[model samples]
Target: MNTETNILNILGEQIKLGERKEVNFDVANLHTASAINVPIIIERSKKPGPTVLFTAGIHGDEVNGVEIVRQLIAKGINKPKSGTVICMPIINIFGFINLKREFPDGRDLNRVFPGSKNGSLASRVAHKLITEIVPHADYIIDFHTGSSGRFNAPQLRIVKHNQQLRGLAKVFGAPFVLYSKNLNKSFRTVCNKLGKPLLLFEGGKSFHIDNIVTNTGVNGAKRILFYLGMLSSKFKVSTPKKDCVFIEESKWIRAKLSGMFKASVKINAKVEKGDLLGNITDPYGKMNYFVKADYSGYIINVNESPVVYQGDALFHITKKLIR
Candidate 1:
């Protein structure tokens, strides 16, 4: 489908482009059952500007944002003198070849949103990837980490009322910046109901690779492509605080009485309103069960699978929620 109009979001939905490198390279239901093809890539830049998309492993064990988009595609993009840069490293190849993190139909591709095209098959592949790659993107960044057993650090989670998307999440520095404030149903609420502007790089976990959340998400996506001029020089990015201590509200503290667990607070600690965040021993510790912190923010995430079950999930509190 190269109608002489540049080639980047390069997907052939109705089917066309051949020498494929995989981007919307269909296969949803063409004969059998073992299928998975959702790829996209673009790099345009003969001037023009603004169009920076960069997603990754939509929860297929959050592969460090597919290594932070191949470290910004090896820092090239050939001609971005002004704009354009799209990528989708790995949307979920059967939950990344059974590495497992949801999406082999167990569903959870970012809670399957903005989808439909006759739904189901992960809602028609998340509605043909939000109608063929995020409405032509002009700012979307979804790369995560912190799932498998659980671990996060290089932060930068926006949705806290999008103050310029939390000033592009502190120029992607990553030392802890988790504002977050979406009422669930994500993909950052389907790119905030179409206005686009999105960002959610939680940082390192699941199968591991935490070079400070991949160097603060590859230099915060090239300091947001040089703060959106597409690049003509721009690289300081990292003041990291737009008052970002919101956490308007949050919840999830399971394992009410299981077996192992120890946590005495670590992953970004800062508790108080009850503080104790650790306990649930048995196998030989002769029974214990502390784990308290009913209120007072900043534990961001917990649970490293030291074996537990009475309810599973251990900590995810954010209090004062943000948004």
Candidate 2:
């Protein structure tokens, strides 16, 4: 193809063969009376191959994903062995600026996919992603973390019966691979409808960067690129020390009473049925309520915040099986 016919991104920036370009998606903001431009980094290889997309910061407070993309760029994603690598480090700029999970309109960006151009702010952003970005990707990796007050072990979540996507999830090499039903109107569901293979990574806690989780995400991305032939096989990336645990069922352990919570176990800890996971106590230490596991499972997530209300989720447990 001629240089004049090179791929042009949403901002009308030309991404020629073997070239790396940073494009901006400018969305006019009426509420702020300003224009908000979201940054996107695109790297194209001279050789033809699959187009992979990496998106993070959908919840704004999910900083580990953003850092992973940033580190990948710093390590030179501009040069690839084959295909294109598109990185949208921060998708929810409004939420990111405010250090929150949802948009200023109180809408969760992840819950509104394939949105309309003339819809609400969250919808518009989602529309831009589905139209401008999703169409270009053969595979996608969406990065995330436990929402505020929670910590998740580095893991990958996928649909229960997608064997193809499940294989890729294993190759990404997180400690755990969770199979669950997709939430309605989520990015994953939209992409699945479009026949795109996408995987979601959950790790660390919102607003805080955990080194272990961040490193796992960075290495996992590199491993994925290597598997896709976009990176050389000789590329050195850390592999999971143990085989990824596949969990088909997971449940959240909620607080039974309102009080201060003290967790006895951390993420990735193994516990038997009725094991003590944590405890809730009054401010004066007069009353104590022990929280125990309902079944034997691995602790995938733990609430880090001390304060808790009745029915607040404090632990996310995935069923464990005996080999």
State which candidate has the highest TM-score: 2
Clashes (backbone N, CA, C under 3 Å), per candidate, total: 11, 0
Segments of candidate 1 deviating more than 4 angstroms = 1-23, 26-53, 63-81, 96-142, 154-170, 176-223, 226-228, 231-239, 242-267, 270-277, 283-286, 289-301, 304-323
Q: Model 1, 204: alpha-carbon shift in Å?
A: 8.0
Q: lDDT score, residue 108, model 2? A: 97
lDDT per model, in order?
A: 0.69, 0.86
Candidate 1 lDDT tens digits, 1-323: 11223444346522112212335546364235756555565656555556677888877777878988877776653125655667787877667777778865698877778768886666676776787778777788888788758776566666555677767765544555566566465678877888888877787588877776687677777767776666545344455443445454667778878798888898767787787888988898688989888888777778778888898888877766544
lDDT tens string, model 2, 1-323? 11223564545667877788888866656466877777898888887778888999999889988988888888875356888888999999888888999999999998998888999889999998899888878889999998867999999999877889888988899988988788999999999999999999999988898899988888888988988878854468677798889988789999989999999997899899999999999999799999999999999999999899999999999974312
C-alpha-based local distance difference test score of model 1: 0.69
Clashing residue pairs for model 2 = none
For candidate 2, the per-residue lDDT at 45 reads 82
